[model samples]
Target: MRTKETVPEEALFAHHQAAMEISVFGKSMDVLHKEDFLRNEEFCILVKLRYLLDNGIEEYAGINESIQLLKASIEAKDSFVIIDQTESRFRGGKQQQFYQFVEGLLTDFVSTEDFQDRLSQQLRETLTQIKTQEGQVALRNYTEQLQKLAERPLALKLLSLFKSYNLADYSLLRQISELVQQLSKKDVRDYQSLKPLIVANYRTFESLGKIISLPPQRSNPDTFMRMTQVLVLEYKYQLPFVQLANLLMVIKRWYQPYQNIIAVREQYPPHRYEQPPDFQTSIPGEAIFLKYKTWLTEKSTGVLFLDLGN
Candidate 1:
């Protein structure tokens, strides 16, 4: 809970105490290996130091002096705990290498931990917004949040996470797909160009379903949206069609005919209609008619269908 920017000095001192207590004995000095002991010390020290630096303790003097003090604290023997195979004559040559390694460790202690801390903070922040006690409801709420904000890039990123993880459910997939479609609205050309992203999100869901033994209901729109978002990210940015087909198959099987009728009607031109009033009574039957209708319409726009009559 102690963020780099907001951690109190007192709390960090407490963490120092806690890290010190991690040894078998309740003190930092009890550790037998000087380097290993310092390594443990370094964890808390680095965290607090970074916290201080983030909060305007910009003086390099204090931190640099602390580093020196830490280095001096290491026993000479512990600094050169090299393998027995090393020749005694080469000890002097190894000292320089040891110094370089220590310096690199110090630098790494500062930069890598700091980066990880920041990344953890960002992840927690984003996850907090999306996660909910209601589980499925929470996912739906998060998907709706992205939709409302029109945050296509963030949504895409989340979608990738969901899909690669196979977090797709019926509700989740529908919501994620809808969000992608929403992003494609006239104002957001960048989002329109993200069709591959949209497709990829769906594909991740499919892959996840195959690998992980999640409940089939996880593919519901709410669950699928979150899962697909995760999945889209997992496939190294490639969208898989097999998953998309599976998802479409699920949707086709489960979706109400009325809803499909509405979608088909919207796809058809206002002046044109399909042949035979009851042509779409069965699921596969409807799919075939719709596919043929789509192909013919593409070939001749509305003219071919209109000329044929209902």
Candidate 2:
């Protein structure tokens, strides 16, 4: 629960503890590797050094020198982490690469007690660069595929619907995964309202002998949404559908913030909406921009307002 700014030493000390479970910079480290922590000799060295640093002991195995190596990042002739204080979002800085650098620190430490101890002077300076910069473009990029998908029309449409496409979560797919609920609706509209139509049609089809009678379904909006999607499959070029909570598994089997969102969804299942009169592909962006909002900076300019949402 520590804010990024105030989370330095507590995070270090927390990692030092034996539970081997803690969150660092918004990412959780589970104790699945707890057994390994007790046996890893290399990890003991690093973590013990961290313990000394945090307690202000001013010594590591009494050597009074930094044993921590700058092995990850290499420069032209030698290896070193980039110490750019000014490189950040919107400044053409490699914020994504920097995030990976910080992520690498946690990744290495966790695999090793599976974790840490102290905020050393150099560490304090390094952690300063790290905490405020997590998942900054939604902590950005998944790979080359992310770059390709991010520039596509479909990615824009999906992001438009989800609303919280972070410049922090860079990978196009993880951004999509985080907001998968929005895509699961089956309303043939945003996919939330399908029960009445399917129920009505089921009875009608049965009465007309177009289909045989069967036991009632364990009825719910979710069921209705799936049942009505076949219609949209037939809609073809005019695909207007929502798959209400279809990918709830991917959403629920995640870590925090997401677990919080899932808890809320459980407390209140997807809300019901009237079945749309007809399927129509949703127009992207705020209607006000399309229908009313005008160009800014100058009223006389004829440019329409654009909602290039994340």
Candidate 3:
């Protein structure tokens, strides 16, 4: 969304909807753009968020994982939730006893006889994707053998929780990454505080692809990428899909009077979109979500949807 040259704040910004159109449906040099699919808002927010991320990357280097650790410590059950327009809950945890509504994903993945083999294969797969250049070297020095990965009592617990995706994967990966950084001098037990990586199954893994392709208004791109990356593997494993990612919130309060700049189009009369109440953002959700314990139950319901708690 960066312009070829810098654009000053006083400059007018025009997009598909706000800009002029020379309509000639599906013809050369004709402008017949579908309004629904246009991503001006996406591009705008992506650019803004990128600015925020670029400026604040250091603070959030481990934000996703860090938050999960805090969440899991207080909560006894799996910590997971799905963010969508419909607010659908993904089923996980004690199904069977967690719930008899459907088969229990946790019981099945953890109780299988060939779980060790599965863990070995999954470890190999996860290793290749590690962004760290020295991750493989660290694994080699730390893990003498791949077959015995899950044999470690903690490793077994970690892998079992990994299938569900939520609190486990981030905590496990971060702890493992930290362990590797420690040159394997510290064992996984040192980070046992990260027990029970909470997994929240929002509806089902089947909806993940749909969510990835057409994300909700507040979906985070990083979360989408992670889910998409996992979908490739889940096709075979069908493991419970849980995600630990961020959300987006655009907050523009009425700090100052609405500007007088107006946008004019040939099709419509001169109109202004740079005013309040008609803007892309609405009332801030962070305070509203966190304050209302009645709306958001204590530990059972998470109160973070505005990108690391607003």
Best by TM-score: 3
TM-score of each: 0.15, 0.16, 0.18
Q: What are the runs in model 3 whose C-alpha is more than 4 Å off? A: 1-56, 77-310
| Best-to-worst lDDT order | 1, 3, 2
- The predicted structure with the larger TM-score, 1 or 3, is 3
Instruction: Give, for candidate 1, the lowest lDDT window spanning 10 residues.
Output: 76-85
Off by over 4 Å in 2: 1-87, 90-107, 111-123, 127-171, 187-310
- Predicted candidate 2 versus true structure: per-residue lDDT over 1-310, tens digit per residue: 4322222344334323311221221121121223343353333333333334334353223211111100000000010001122234324234444434443443243221122221122233444454455423222322222233233423322222222222222232222222222333432433345455545444322221111111234233343343234223223212111221111122122223323323333343323322222112222222222222231112565532222221
- Backbone clashes for every candidate come to 43, 29, 11
Q: Summarize candidate 3's per-residue lDDT along 1-310 as a digit string, tens digits.
A: 4323332334333323222221111121112122221223322222323333434443233233322322232121122111110012322232112122111322445543365454445446555655554544443332333234334333333333443443322333333233223422322221222222212222222233221222243234444333222222222222211110111121211111111122222222225223323233222232332332222222554432223221
Model 2: how far is 264 from its true place, Å? Answer: 48
- Candidate 3: residue 28 Cα off by (Å): 40
Locate the minimum summed-lDDT window of 10 residues in model 3. Answer: 78-87
- Model 1 Cα lDDT, one tens digit per residue, 88-130: 2223333334323322332233343453343334434444443
lDDT, candidate 3, at 96: 17
Root-mean-square deviation of Cα positions for candidate 1 versus the true structure, in angstroms: 33.7
TM-score of candidate 2 on Cα atoms, chains taken together: 0.16
